[model samples]
Target chain A: MNKTIIEIVDSLEVSKVYAELSDPQSGGICVFVGTVREVTQGETVVALEFETYRNMALKEMEKIALEAVEKWQLNKVVIRHAIGAKKVEDPVVVVGASAPHRDACFEACRYLIDTLKERVPIWKKEIFKNKTVWVSAHP
Target chain B: MEILLFGIAKDIVGKSKIQFAAGEGQPTSVKELRQTLESAYPDLGRLSSMAVAVNSEYVRDELILKPGDEIAIIPPVSGG
Candidate 1:
């Protein structure tokens, strides 16, 4: 409702978020992507499964956007996180912010991801051939 | 009274919306609500950890609940 102020998508296509942030009026657009690496805490991760209480996840995401806007007085923000199964090298989370200048965009985008990691209700389970671990929080 | 439920809390209860009586002159705290939840639905007690938030702000057990306030019971999860 606020000029596409924030977009949350549950898809694997994260590059589109970059394209959306490339508006001419926005002098600064910051992007952050969280990818699935081959290892975590010395263990090789075969794949990762992300789960969310959909309704509350969305609410928490929106809350993040609102807080960013209020805190930095930014122009717009976008956050997208992939759900279900994701393999190595796949992009799992994407966050972007666009503003009149670069510093605010970068700061706000970073804050959004950091706070979202701490506050959002999404969960991830790492799957390996020999064992599985449920992570309670992201480092 | 409206109770804010999220994540594992919603899953255990099988519904996102929860309602309870707010008796006259009795205010509910986050801890009390959690105890009530564990009593009413035993499965929630098994969760690893949970944090309570009122209107998107995390608070301690002594935080009082108000009618119509959004509440979220956050369970720790590994996510980015």
Candidate 2:
């Protein structure tokens, strides 16, 4: 089994994540990155604060990686998410998938990101100029 | 049993870990645990949704809890 990397970090480096997915056996590698947005709805975002159930987040991420590989026949999967305070435009999450074919790699990358957002035990708080609110908390 | 809180749950409870004694029913099942928590801390009931995690995985209503299992409350997650 190829090494699957999953981490909840304070900061995310795109170059480092790309370097980790260097699997020569795999012919294709696909990556997806999520960044802090400058605006949320009609309000301007000043920053973002992330909270995570670290242990569960890691376990869920590993589970996601395993499921992606099993479903898409992927060779390697990397899932990383940032926690703590982050300025606008900072990287929030990164997902990389490597496989023998481009189709599997791309599909796995999308599936991993979507599943992570839905299932992982991590929360994001949006900070505006005068207010701070939890994402999805509003009606 | 002690339960760890995150996100909005932490804010509602005003602490990361909350301790409470088992009541008359001493609900061992997560379904009963939810009622116990809501009764103790009414703020938890206001949340749009919340879930219990045992041993780092979300379990269904029927899963019974051991005395010393890693337990935490998960509010609606919104990670990227």
Q: Say which docking band candidate 2 falls in.
A: medium
Error of 1 at B42 (Å): 10
lDDT of 2 by residue, A41-99 (tens): 98999999999999899999999999998998777889999999999889999999988
Model 2 CA lDDT for position A29:
94
Candidate 2, which segments miss by more than 4 Å at Cα?
B22-25
Give the number of the best model, judged by TM-score.
2
Residue pair clashes in candidate 2: none
The sequence of per-residue lDDT tens digits that candidate 1 reaches over residues A22-109 is 6666888898999999988888999988877566677778888888878776767787788888899998888888888888898998
User: What DockQ does candidate 1 score?
Assistant: 0.33
List ranges where model 1 is wrong by over 4 Å.
Answer: A1-10, A137-139, B1-29, B36-48, B53-73
Report the error of model 1 at residue B80, Å. 1.3
Clashing pairs in 1: A135-B78, A136-B77, A136-B78
